[model samples]
Target chain A: MKIFGINLAGPVREEVERFLASNGLKLEKDVEYTAVAVCREEIVGTCSFAGNVVKCFAVRPDWQGAGIAAQLLTHISDILFSKGITETFIFTKPENGQLFSGLGYRSVAATPQVILLEGGTANIGRYINEMVREAGINGTEKAAIVMNCNPFTLGHRYLIETAARENEQVIVFVVEENRSCFSFTQRLNLVRQGTADLTNVIVIPGGRYIISANTFPTYFLKDRQISVYQELDALIFARYLAPAFNIRIRYVGTEPHCQVTNNYVEALQKILPSYGVKVCLVERVKSKGECISASRVRQLYEKCHWEELRDLLPPCTYDFLRNYPNPGSQANQAD
Target chain B: MDIKHPAKAGSLESNDIYVMVEPSSEEGIVLELDSIVMRQFGRHIEAAIKETVTKLGIDNIRIVAKDRGALDFTIKARVETAVKRALEE
Candidate 1:
C-alpha cells in the first residue's frame, strides 16, 4: 500500500467518501487536507486534517491490521509539521485509541464512546513560549491573569493593578473566543484602554489554548460537565503554560455570584500549588457594599441601568456602554 | 503459550497505556512498542512489557503496546489482561 496527499475534489474525493462510508464514516467538508492509503489504486484508509484537528479518519476492515491507519496519520502529521502546526487533535472511538496513541497522541478528553487525543508533546508549552518571546519579557516575578472581560469593569482593573503592583511583570490573557455578547475584539480593546495606565500589565490574546472550546467548553454557558472541563483547563495552565512563562502567581477575582467561576478557582487551587504556581483570589471590587461583576454590567445593560452601570465600570467601560447600543436591544430585535 | 485470538486491554487515557495482543505464528514473542515517554524510558518500558509477557508464560504472540506514560504496575496489569483475554478458552 502507498500513501499520497489528495485535494478534496473529483474522483479522489469520491474514493475518499466511499472509503469513509465503508467504515461507517463520512467525509467532513471542513477538512483542509487529506491523505489516502491506496492498495491497487483503491483507497483503503483515509485521514484528513483541518488546521491542527484530525477529522474523517478511517481504514477499511480488511486493511485495519496492515498499519494503514498509522501510515495515513504519519503522512498527515508530516505535512502539518512542515507547515509549523505541531499540536494536533483527533477524535475516534475508544477501541481504535491504541492506533493513534501508538503514533504519539495522548488522550486529553474522553467520553465512554469517543476520546479526544492531542497529537503533540508540548502544545501548551509551545504557545506560552511563543507568547513570552513575542512580548520579549524576561522577569523572574512574572504573574498572569486570564479574564474574559466581556466589558472591562473596575473589578477587572483592580485585579490587574493589584497583580502589577505585586509582580515585576503581569501577563493579561484576554479570552479570545467570541462567544459572549461583546465580540473578542471589543473586549480586548476595552481591556487595553481600561488598563492603559498600568505599565507592568501586558495584554495578549489567549488564542485557542486558554479557556478554549477544546480545553474549557463551558465558559459562558453552564453544563453538567462544567467542573470536569474547568479542572482540565486549570491543569493545562498550572502544569504547562505557567512554567513556560516563569509565572509564579496567578491572579483571579473572587466570584461571590457565579458558581462556575468559583468552581474554576477551586480547581485552580487544587492543582496550581503542586506545579509551583500560587493562586491568588483578590476580592472583587465593591461599590456601596455590592460586588462589581461583568455580569452585573451586562444585567444593567439589559435593564438600561446606565446610572448603576456607571458606578460599577471604569470611565472607558462606561463610555463604551454609553456609545455602543445595549446588546440586549440588538438581541431583542428580529434577525 | 500462544494467543488464540486478538484481545485488548487498558486505555489510551492520559498516563495510561493500551495493549493489543493477537495470535501469531512466529517462533517467539513479537512486540511493537510506542510511547510518549519513548525518548526518556523506552528501554525500561520495553523491558517491562517483555517481563510481563515472560511472567504470563506467553511466548508466541504479537503484542502491540501503545503507552501514554503509564507506570510499571499499570503496564504489567494491562499486558496481563490482554494476554489472558487473548488466551481465553
Candidate 2:
C-alpha cells in the first residue's frame, strides 16, 4: 500500500503505534514537524524521538523504494533540530538494504533492527561580523554613499567606483530597520562584500536616526540635538573621522531612485557645505540604455529576468546575482 | 510625588564648576555633571541631563547634585528645588 494519511482505525495506525511503542519512542508537543506530520490523514512512515533528537524513521515495507523514507526522515529531522536534537538516527531491518541505500538513511553502525540517522548542520553562519572598536577606518576624505542600493546591483558598483576614484575615503551608511526586503545589515554587507576591492570605502551603521527618525520626527528624544547634539555629532565625525584621516568630500547619486532619498540628498547638500564637505552627485550608471536604479532592478529580480540584469550590473555584481540562490528579486530599499 | 525638603546649606566644592545668577547665561546653562555622575552611570548621564535640562529650564541655580543613580526625574526635581531656593535671592 502506498503510504498516505493516518486514520486512527486503519491498519497503518495500529502498526505505527505498535512501532512507536516497540521502539520506546514518543511524539513531541508543539513541534511544527511533529504536529503537522502526526496529524496528517496520510502517513506512509513512522519516526519518533523523546528529547530533541530523532530516534528512528521507517517507511512501510511496501512503500520503501518510492523515497517516502527520505520525506519522513527530513520531516522528523526538522522536528528534532527544533527540539535541540542536533544528532538524529534511525533503526530498521537489515534485509531491506536496497531501499535504505538510495534513501536519506545514511547507514552508521547498524544493529539488526537499527540504523543511525545523521543529523547534520549545513552552512548556517548567521551571526553579524564582530564590530571591533579599532578595525574601522580612521580618517580620509570621508565620502558617505547614501544609497538604498536595494541589493547592490552593478550600477551601484559603478557609482561607488567613480566615487572612490575622486575621493580619498568613502563610507556607505546603511539605513537600519527598513521595512524593505533586504535588511539594513544585509544591504550593508552586500555593499561591503561587493566593494571589498575598493581601498577607501568604509561601511558605517547610520543607525535609524537619519533613516526613520525623519519619518516619525516627534520621538527623536534628542530634540535639541537638531542644533547642538547633531552639530556635535557631525563635529565628531569631522574632528575624529576627517582630521584623523583627512576627509573632505562626500559622493552621492543624483535623484529619482527614491523620492524620499532625493529630499535627503537635497538637505545634506545644503548642511554639508558649511562643514567644508563638498557633495558629489554622479549621473546614474546605465546598462543597455536604461538607468540602473533599485526599483528597476527589483522589478527584474522579482520576474527572474537574469538576461536583463546581466546588462544592468557589473561583472562582480553579475556573479553575485548568478550565484545567489534566487535572483531577480524585485526590491529597492534605499530611500 | 512631592519631594520638597529643607535646602542643605554648605560650601560649594572647589574644582567643581559653579555659577552665581547672571542675566546673560539665563537662556540655558548646561553644567557638566560628569564629575559627579561619571563614576557611576558614565555616559548615560549625559543623555539623562538633556532630558532633565529641557523640562526644568535655566531657572534652577546651584545644582550641586551628588548624583549616584539619579534618573531624569530626580535630576529635574533636585535642580528645580535648588533653583526655587535661589529664586528667594
Candidate 3:
C-alpha cells in the first residue's frame, strides 16, 4: 500500500505485483508514507556505493536535510578505503546525484546510485509486515484498538483519532481502575461517553496491569507514558492483529519531553523494523507551545480551576471533569 | 573541560591489573598494561579505548584495564557508561 510505503513497499502491478502479493506486501494506494517515515525507528542518512553501479542514494523525508545520507555515504566510503577501493562511482537522477557528488563520490552521469558492496551485502531488508503477519489485509476495513485512557488528555485523543480515521472499527483502551482521577466505570464511561458521537469508535477496559509495569521501567522518564506504551502496544498488536486483520499502524505521540524514552527509541527503531511494525510519533495536542497534559488538567481540576483546563483538553474531557468522579469509582487505586 | 583535553590518572583495580592514562595531559588517554592479558591484543583494546574515550570527551585519564575476560565492546560500554555516569555526576 502507498500508506506505510517506506516500511512495507507494498504490492506493485503485474508480475512484480504478483510477487509482492505473494511475498506479503499489502500496498495501500491512498495510505501515506508520511506517517511511516515519522514512525521509522532508525534510518540514518542512508547512502550507498555499489557492485553494478551506485545509482541511488536517498534519505527518508523525515531524515532529509540532517546530512544523514551524506554521513552514511562517508562511512561506507571509509569501509571501501580499507578494502583498497579509493575511487567509487554513483549514478542517480541528475538532481539526486548531487548528493553523491557532495560526498566526494564523483558524478559520472545522472544514473542509478545502486551499489555493489565488496562482499555481497545481505538481502536482509525484508518488508516489516511480511515477517510479522501471516495473512494481510488489502482493503480499507481494519479493526479498532483498545487502549488505556489513563488521565484522558489531548495525546490520548490524537492516538484514537489517528486510528479511527484509518480503521473501520475503533476500540479505546481505558484503565478499568477508579483511582484514575475519574474512576473505572467512570473512566470507561468518560471515554465511552466522549467518543459516543463517533460512529466507529468503541470504548473498552484495558485489562489489569498486564500493560502496567509491562515495559522497562526506564521508559517512565518519558514526558508521556503513552510514548513508551506505543512500542509495547505495537509489538503486542502486530503479534496478534496482523493475522486477523491488516493492523498497519500504531499511533503515538512524540516524547519531546522525554529524552530517556528517545534513547530507548533508538533501540526500538532498530528492533521494530525487523518486525515490520513502523512506530509513528504524532505531534502533541497543544494549546500553545505546551501540549495539553493530563497532569496539568488534573491539577487544574483538583485546584478547582476547571476553566483553565479547557485550553488543554477537548470539551468532552472537560464535561467529564465537570461530572467529576466516574468510572469504577469505588474500586481503583491511583498508583 | 571547555576544551577537548586529555586526562592522565592511575587507577588500580585489584592486584596484578593496573591502568594508566597516557599523555596524561591532553585530549588523549593511554592505558598501560601490567597484567598478562596486556600482551594479548591488550594494546588494540587500549587503542580502541583511547578512540572511544576521546569521542567520550575524556582528556587525561589512562585506565589500566585489568580485563578479566571482558569483551572489547563490553569494556567500551562499561567504561563509557562509567565515564558518562561520572561526568553526569
For every model in order, what is the iRMS?
Answer: 9.9, 33.0, 19.3
Q: Candidate 3's residue-wise lDDT over A224-280, tens digit each?
A: 444444344344444444333444444455557766445545534544456565655
lDDT of 2 by residue, A5-27 (tens): 34444465555655555545333
TM-score of each: 0.58, 0.41, 0.37
Better structure of 1 and 2 per DockQ: 1
- Which ten-residue region of model 3 chain B has the weakest summed lDDT? B9-18
lDDT of 1 by residue, A217-260 (tens): 32113326666666667777776678777889999898787887
Every candidate's fraction of true contacts kept comes to: 0.07, 0.00, 0.00
The list of candidate 2 runs beyond 4 A from truth reads A1-135, A212-246, A256-258, A315-335, B1-89
Query: Candidate 1, residues B1-89: lDDT per residue as tens digits?
Result: 67787766766556777676776645787776778888999999999999999988887887767687999999999999989987887
TM-score ranking, high to low: 1, 2, 3
User: On DockQ, who's better, 2 or 3?
Assistant: 3
Judge the docking of candidate 1 as incorrect, acceptable, medium or high: incorrect
Whichever of 1 and 3 has more lDDT, that candidate is: 1
Please state the error at residue B11 of candidate 1 in Å: 25
Worst 10 residues of 1 chain B by lDDT: B7-16
The residue-by-residue lDDT of candidate 2 on B1-89, one tens digit each, is: 11122232111122121111212222344333423436566566555544554464443322323233455555555555444444453
Model 1 spans > 4 angstroms off? A1-87, A90-97, A103-123, A212-215, A218-223, A325-335, B1-89
How would you order the candidates by lDDT, starting with the best?
A: 1, 2, 3
**DockQ of predictions, in order shown:** 0.05, 0.01, 0.01
